[model samples]
Target: MAEHGGRDARMRDAEARVVGTVEFVLDVRVEGMVHAQAVRSPYPHAVIRAVRTDDALKVPGVLHVLTGAELEADPSVDPYFGSPRPDQPVVAIGKARYAGDPVAIVIAETTAAAAEAVPLVDVEYSELPYVVDALDAARPGAPVLHEAWPDNNCGSWRLRHGDCDRAMAEADRVYSGTYHSPSASHVPMEPMVCLAQWHGDRLDVQTSAQAPHAVREALERMFGLAEGAVRVRTLNLGGAYGAKTQVKIEPMVACAARAVGRPVRMELARDEMFQTTAKHAATVQLSTGVRHDGTIVARRVSVAYNAGAYALSSPGASGQGLTRANGPYTIPNVSIDCVATYTNTVPTCPFRGAMTSQLAFAYESQLDEIAADLGMDPLALRRKNLLRDGDVYPTGEQMHDLHYDAVLDDLEHAIGWDRPPEAAPPGKARGKGLAIMLKNTLTPSRSQARLRLRADGRVDVHSSSVEMGQGASATVLQLAADHLGISADRLVRGFPDTDVTPYDTTTSSSRTTYAMGLALQRAATDLKAHLRTLAARHWHVDPQDVTVGGGSVARRQEPGADMAWEELLSAADLAELVGEGTFAADFGLLLMDDPHDVHGPVTVHWHQGGAAAEVEVDLETGRIEVLRMHANCYAGRVVSPHRVRQQNQGCAVFGLGPTLFEELLYQDGTVSNPNLSDYMIPSILDVPEVITSSALESDDPRAELHGVGEMALPAVSPAVANAVFAATGIRLTELPLGPESVLRALDERRRNDDQEGTTR
Candidate 1:
């Protein structure tokens, strides 16, 4: 109920008010529709000795039973991005890789029947040795999850630049530490449900996926059908937060429908949701060398990722290991080697900021130490090494129009940063810390927008960018309304349909507000331009003489002569006009096509953000509560101030979770905290009160609009962790410095001091 950012005062948080869009879902009386369910492995590693389906078939209303070997109805599904990474089969083929691996599926007349038939289908298992920890999995003689790869490892991303040894030798101080980053779940309010039906050559699949086209492509390949034969339509998503970015039950549902020759729907219970999909844990080793002036002279970092069972989301695009390798500041000499190995855990998927959040913890935390050691202001240290425009990354990606120092400078003023106390609050330890970061919406990751002038003279917009409760569609609608010279409500929003909608890169990287908005601007302008021709013909004047505004065309100098939108359309003998567009970050200088190699260097784009956090560390309990948050993002433009604030709140809350309380516990080959009860997420009350988020923007040619989604999250945890260390002189590298962890750090400090006093 509290006021959001400065937008239309009449609207709260610039939230697009949809009056009649909601259709009360009515229970349908269908002639023939069936329900289905799945049977999963209760063991981590096992072999499919035999599957007996006779007992399941005998259950009343139980239609049929299916196993991985019998799942021949659908061909193999392709992995995301069409890489050589192993594709998850519609069902397990030979052996069960991890706990919750789907070995078989079933169809029945009723939900009750399907539930009853699950246990009746018997599956014999031969247990096998499993490696759960990624680091342990890489050791010699460790159990290999995949026999083909001798030492279990999934993927590697390595980047080396400058003189590493020379820089280390010149450094006055060198600091090294190990940080443990844990996995968390997406926990979309609506668990996950997919309904798939195929009739001859045509397929209709309804799902709650953040990435619809990705799901469609995977489904198309799975059934071995022509691209046109498969159609994926997304419905109102409860929430995504990057977890739904990957396809989950769509393939299984489609496979079941094909096997049963009828529509099949699959939905996971809340408990199964915990294990089947969640964030993957990562272990990172970070080291840095600094000069007496607080300049980062040398850096070396390595990452070991727990790419659960299979390599679903283990490419390590922007993760903890990579974060250690490089981030916002300039480290002239750097060497980074990151390895993502295979383990018998659920394949880790992208959640919110993905790997960036974990990396910020290490990089930013270390930065604070470097600044303190040199007796320098933390903000000044960041400003000194902050990357300016045209900086090149070790990955050979040149940063365009970067403004890291400006971002930090802006936050210092916005938050009134005068270095709040870092020691305990009187009897308590309260501290303040700030961190800076950047990210990109990324290109070839296309987002589409369609604009059509409706019969009433208002533009109708269509896109596949799922709302994900991020207010994306609302932001697009505002942009269209502003462009078309009409009221915001006049823009007609189209329903979600893959067959009709253009390809969307899926909303992440803080792209929707900028990259997608740019494309929408183009599409709307095109529509208005074409309409000018219609108006010119009606007025018997040159098209250039016509002026566009308020959904009408008028003579440039003639105020009263402006033609109304409806009149122009009527004169043109059409009820509506149409236009379409798509845009991604331009990578002209970043990439070059090579005939020999599949791809070439695509330099990174620029995004700069700064944030300051205030924390109250209770000594009695070690409960660290964030009291205030402030940030400034030079993301080119604030498309909608209200929308950007929500984006900021989301990133802050997500960043705070792992900083204070969230951990994935593992014992032997099994996950200990696969459920939310054990892995704590921030509640409403857990969110801070002083949280303030805002952005800075200026026009630049390098990127149409600077991307800002994940950038703010990377620095948050490290800022908090560094603040805790600044107060207590206790540097805890592990994540989720929960109450117990904090107590342990303080206790160790006490023990060390006592021993020194006794020895003296």
Candidate 2:
């Protein structure tokens, strides 16, 4: 076979995708299918007195208008739905929590007809007091979104490792700072879409879902249906960076289909996509205690995430923030309190890196500040406190498989950390900075897959791992080809379907490569065993005496007993043979009852990464230009080194938009810039002159595959901020470090310097 796992291997579906032949959820249509449009609320916080859909029903081509009250009264299906908690309603239940909240669905023969009727569906609301900020929402008397959570807190977690109080008191000096990160949208190429149809009480859903099994389970629970009644399937997703995790529009579309007695498809408009889900806007307060020698003794961190209007993934994301708020350094005493507070805006979900990016920016930037106070190089200080193998983590578990040093070393060399700063243009100043971070994969999850050997000698691998432009399908095909000793072109892969493919927890957290890859490996091994058995029976030899390799089977003792896979299968008179396998993470308690105590073994493995950047800041215009960036992540036993580097580089550039210019501009608790025209992402002109990425591998034979998808993201924001600070002696504690903020800071600094000069 042509070099196993070659770097030039292209995705199996790349050509189809490029040619626009691949069918997405939006392209799916069936007989008698209809379109749906949501009538949204305009007020951020309000009580829904009534939803009058009489006018909407009178419009031409309008079939039906379904409201939350009707579903609640039906008693057949529950209107409330959310992940980790049943808090979000399918439509505005008694109250509309945020602007753009769907109060009713208008189904019509066409999308335009449904949209035309949406304005006619009137909703009366009584506006209530609202809080848009996390810290403000968490205060004593804020407008509470849900009565169950009186304090406006959606979720809360606290981690206390050692005695932080005593460590702070005994320390030589202390430092404190507060940081802020704004909420941002995913802006995937394909907006959220779902199509649902019911066949005589059996629910069938075709959606752009990252977790088909989870979506099926949720639908079954919601509709009170049997396990086998609800079927969820997915096509290739254009992109889903945690925005399409469990369920976005599936539940609502399913409900509409059942109500209308026809196939209903709902495609979120570009503006509506912004209101569907968002990244958490967070505020972090950090206090560090250090000795005169620059050794960090204790760190106290308090973080509040703005989980707008509902509890989507905030509970789990907040817990993650609590665990990772402490930097990659080895600190003996650490106290962290991370809470998700309810705000009147779009509900927040996990972005690419979840809560790690927000936490890394706070701690890493502060670490550089601490180094400056001690008159020491930031790199030297990081080396002094870097966590090593067998170090005790705050979760009371011993950490192993650490490759932070290798990652940092690669970044340091790539960015020339030891070299002096290059001369900048007359209007610019130049400097360099670096950052390191740690993240955990989703724990206690499971993945199951199946392999089938056809009579034609081609193998089929069935898995529920969604292919969301992340090369999941490609990775599986490559791994299976090498393991089964077959060419990649001979492998046929199946898309994620609840009826055919088995269960997978979700496609987020970068866990598919390791978890699903292992599942396929076991399945391939099982297939090999079955092939050996068939060959042994045909040749009248012991099963162990039959060897299976290189797409052929042979009896070990006889030279003429060898047969190819197709010949052996024909001899056995078998049309096809199948095998199954599964992989489940070590089950550990994720949360504990005690507020100050957390369970051990939180993640399957730690994902480590580092990023370095050289930037030139324009003193005249206050604009920042990235000259170059180098990012690397630890990938134990890499399956595709090329893919790892691509992911690392893409994540680093993706991180730049949020760090420098991306923010969901909000006006009075409403997203003001929801379209691409107003919201700026990284265009070709914004990318750095030089961008490079690589992967660090371990020599240990026992090393397993580590995910590189999200590891590089958390390091990006901090690295850029530190570089800007080094270029100019000004510190910025907020995200999206735009030119306006930089100019304002510079003006303040100039005024202060003038005052000091006058005194002299």
Candidate 3:
């Protein structure tokens, strides 16, 4: 296993090097392809009074300019895409709901020409009142982004397990607080790009996406094409995080391609990427009932998610938030009400941790608040309520292979939780804090793979799982090689091509390595059986007597009967052997009819993780520097220890930006800091001095393998916030604890302290 693991790293690095040399989708050249640029709306909400494309079409290289009116008139173009409801239009039709909303596409012979023509296209708009805040949008008589929804509420989800009012009435103490998380951008190095071409009845698209199959389905539905007529191809992505999980700009490019009778390429600029989709900024109100002995009796949480102009995946995100509001602890009674509100801002989608991170920031911070109120150690309270094996979740799902206690112990030791730290400078304060998280692995989805054995004894594995720098392709290669009894070097990783590779669900929810890996294993197993049957027929022996090992087949009882795989295939007169396998979750067993109902499992598997952080705060500048961070999570079996550690550490560092200095600042309805110059992400210099992580192996057979991609992210932010509270006894309930906010909090703390001293 160790040797195979090493080979996986080498193969992954080789693939990375090859991908690094090539440009992304924007640079994928196709003959007779034209460049397309979108003319976006400048107003957050406005009436599209007129659109004149005469000047744009008169440009020397301009081929065509397509407007939303044309799309709305065409019966073939659906023009809208979203989950639960198709609300987001491909282009602004009669009205533009948000700034940067695409209203027209200008296609020209060259990219420069297309860009130049974009400004020449005239679009008249009448501005309308707009609200960007989620809470403000939810108010009665607020400006509704969608006319179909009068309340401006996109969707609402609730989970009711027990009687929260009664439980709180009987508890010894109750603590309540409101926590806020800001909207942030994914900012993948390679922004959203798509290249689409139409050939007769078929439509082909090459895009930077996490889910090619989903994109193919969306395109087929929008273009009114046959199921197999639309093909989606994906290359190595610079990064996806979670932004690329859904359809972005493929529909626009496809429309432009068909209009111009040639291929069309569109790549979003950095500012456009920022305004297209972002993380849902959420406001959570949490009330916890606890006993004097540090036992949580009941919990009630109300969350409002900023769905921003359209309900893309906000319903699902809101459901996930409601389900995970209880965190990783054991509570008798829990009530959660989560709602996604429509606001005139960029539509919200999943980020690294989805809405789970936002909820963790609330519940974990509330846990610390409760601990302080009870005068009990925060870690001790967590240890007391840690869920054990067989414990039931608030949703009535049975917990399995939960190693929260063990993970906490490892995290505490790694962060020196019990050890007294060296004294800090007179003006600096140092403290340690911990936070735990639980996430559900998406389920009830289908994943299929095709394994083909070449004539030269090599193997090729094909699937639609996008290699978005998550080490998914490398893991699949290792699993296939091991299962086929061949060296990992002999296997070739196949690119994701919808026409060739079997269908796979999107590569999000950390399910690629677990779900797709299972499919690949089954396919390889079937191929091996086929090889054994072929060898047995040649040797005139029973199939059971044929043994396949080390890329060779032999008769078990006969001497000198070993034959190389290639020789056997040649003798059988076969060019290659192919095997297909699929893994489908039983929705009957996995999904609950009403996720809001308290019973039944809502997810296929649970992801458990925790983090510990040590922070030093400067009293003068209000700057908080993380001295070190330690994270731990259960990764049933380590595919590549190096990759696993890298993912954990990367997520930890990513969490730093959201916790300290990342936010999409909004004024009226425009994003003030749309570019990286103003919107901050953590750089190498921002990383801590000592970063440590550990992946624990689970003993339960049910947890043979699990995902580690997003395990550590949700926990890191709350851990840092808790550390800040520990250092200064000031509780910050909002995200991106910037220097200004920190200073304001400090001043408030000092004022309150001075008042107390005078009164005494």
Candidate 4:
């Protein structure tokens, strides 16, 4: 058996976290540090007219108050920062785009002092008309958020293959439906925190961020500093999901620090955290053309994403949403158009599943609709159109290593899909449903790692992948230990520090293990080579004749001549050795035959996964209780079975909230449920009665390791919804499948049935 490939090893930091020894950014404290707080705007859209800081300055312990007017007037600092567009200002400059927008920052010697002065530094504003919905914001007459984008559209994308119109027109039948997913919060245990200090021309920052290097780059650009003048450090995060992916409150705190001439730390309150970022509320329209035999011939999809106030990650998220909206089926012709529109709300970033959940909820639920209309079993319909190895995806990339059938087979066994439907209790109806999806990882990215061999026969691997409770640190150590032929205890794992650790793109998109793991593997190989050279020099043997394996060096000619690493290093008069490796996923269109195609492959590999759900719905109240859930994924190779399964189970629970109870409530452009007391998330009691998860391993020798972070999430909501439809013969297309909505749909269904009966 492999040393660590298939083992169900425990997480490296599990003990530390359980014992309360893990250090998050919130626990970090710098000497002479001050506290900072923001004064938020009350209007969704308003023009700043005057500043009133005299009263705030009178507050005891308040050191400085920095306003948007001062920030805009400063020639050294660039106020705007964001991806795809630089429209989001560090503080509201001439105008505040949304409610809760920061208009001024107050820095004080204590947290209480800063909090006390925040309300005293209120600013004057002239309110303007605002639009909150994506569809309404995109119309011509709606309130425009950005002048550059007059139509209030942030970004747009289109993917066309073959002839969708012709195929749809010539199909046996066509079905269309629209699905909606409301904005939701990540609600990580630890709210956002940032601490920044300046030393001469150099600046240092420690934050709870998933992308420290990206933060460093943004800081440098914002301050016009040298490339390496700024250093960003990220410790273990309580939980980020994607809330902490990009720049958030760092610049504001940095500016406050500069004003106060002291280290400034800001820990956002729960309400402030809600105002920071959210998952994009999306509307997806799908039209599928299918034959009488359950073959899908054509598909067209339109997706409009509410980008909120900025285009931080909308371009990539919406484009990927369009691609995944095609589902895991084979269609000869496909066309997709996805757009992100600006709205008067808190900006949206990536969530747990990125952009896959909402799209999956739309297409997968509609697939069951098609199967029902055609009088065919839903499972049979999915099997007939499932994409397999050697198939060409709509993105023009050739597919390989697909294990959708295996995943489906596992789901079937877990849920007893072939068994007869069981009877429900008095007022309940029982049903079963299945859904499958294809997710893609971030591509054209890179990761670098360094392995240092110590004189004590130990190894230290420096990596920039943040833990964030995803088992990345543990996975890295496992891969390195296996490659070095050493026990895990002999290896030391390093967290993310831009000054010491190597560069990584970010921790989202589920690419850390695949990209960073390969980098570590390469670094281990390089270190082994260095060990062999050092051993050969000490023993007066040819370098090629010496081998380094099993944590020791041996002369190939003499089987009994093996020297321990520490002994060999001491004999060679060397204190330590270092090895560096880098992995970049840059190439694309590997098998595309079309020379005119300019768009490269959007993902490194497709994550094929599926879920099966057994639910009991109350016919009288339209309440749903998920009895059991089984999630399966084509994980290619398993590093730690325990971690993979744990991730899948967590994903099911995470997906459950958005499916049944979670939604950000907006009242007149401001979030009403910003705190835990109002916003409901899944708790221990909400877990399904019987939940099972598995990762299918590939038998092929060339199979590669695929990240399982987001593999099982996309199908969760759709599976539960499909089961509900099967139980009641009523289709609901909206999210958060609340009791009120379900009951309303049931009443409407009954009325339709009565009308048809009268006609009959």
Q: After superposition, how far is residue 258 of candidate 3 from its true place, in Å?
A: 0.5
Query: How close to the true structure is residue 548 of candidate 3, measured as C-alpha lDDT?
Result: 84
Question: Which stretches of candidate 4 lie above 4 Å from their native place?
Answer: 1-5, 588-600
Give the per-residue lDDT of model 3 (tens digit) for 48-145: 99999999888899999999999889887788877667898888999999998999999999988888899999999999999999999999978878
- TM-score, prediction 1: 0.90
The runs of at least 3 residues in candidate 1 whose Cα sits more than 4 Å from the true structure, single-residue gaps closed, are: 1-6, 9-31, 72-86, 316-324, 410-427, 536-542, 555-560, 584-604, 699-704
lDDT tens string, model 4, 1-760?
A: 1112478667766788889999888999989999999999888998888869999999999999998889889999998998657888888888888888998999999999989999998688899999899999988799988888899877777778889999999999999999999999999999999999999878899999999999999989999999889999988998998999978889998888888889999999999999999999999989999888989999999999999988888866777776677888888899988889999999999998888999999999999999999998888888899999877778877777777778778888888989856999998888898888888887667899999989998888899999899888888898888888888889987778898899998999889988998899899889999998888888888999998888899998999899999888889888999888888986543223432242557677889788889999998888889989988777778888888898889888888999999999999998989999899999988899899898888875457888998888989999999999988887889999988888999899999999999999
Relative to the true structure, candidate 4 has a C-alpha RMSD (angstroms) of 2.3
Query: Would you list the C-alpha lDDT of every candidate in the order shown?
Result: 0.71, 0.88, 0.86, 0.87
Clash totals for all candidate models: 8, 0, 0, 0
For each candidate, what TM-score against the reference?
A: 0.90, 0.97, 0.97, 0.97
Per-residue alpha-carbon lDDT of candidate 1 for residues 404-454, written as tens digits (9 for 90 to 100): 766776667655678565445555777777887655444446777888877
RMSD (Cα, Å) for all candidates, in order, is 4.0, 2.2, 2.2, 2.3
lDDT of 3: 0.86
Clashes of 2: 0
For model 2, the stretches where C-alpha displacement exceeds 4 angstroms are 1-6, 588-596
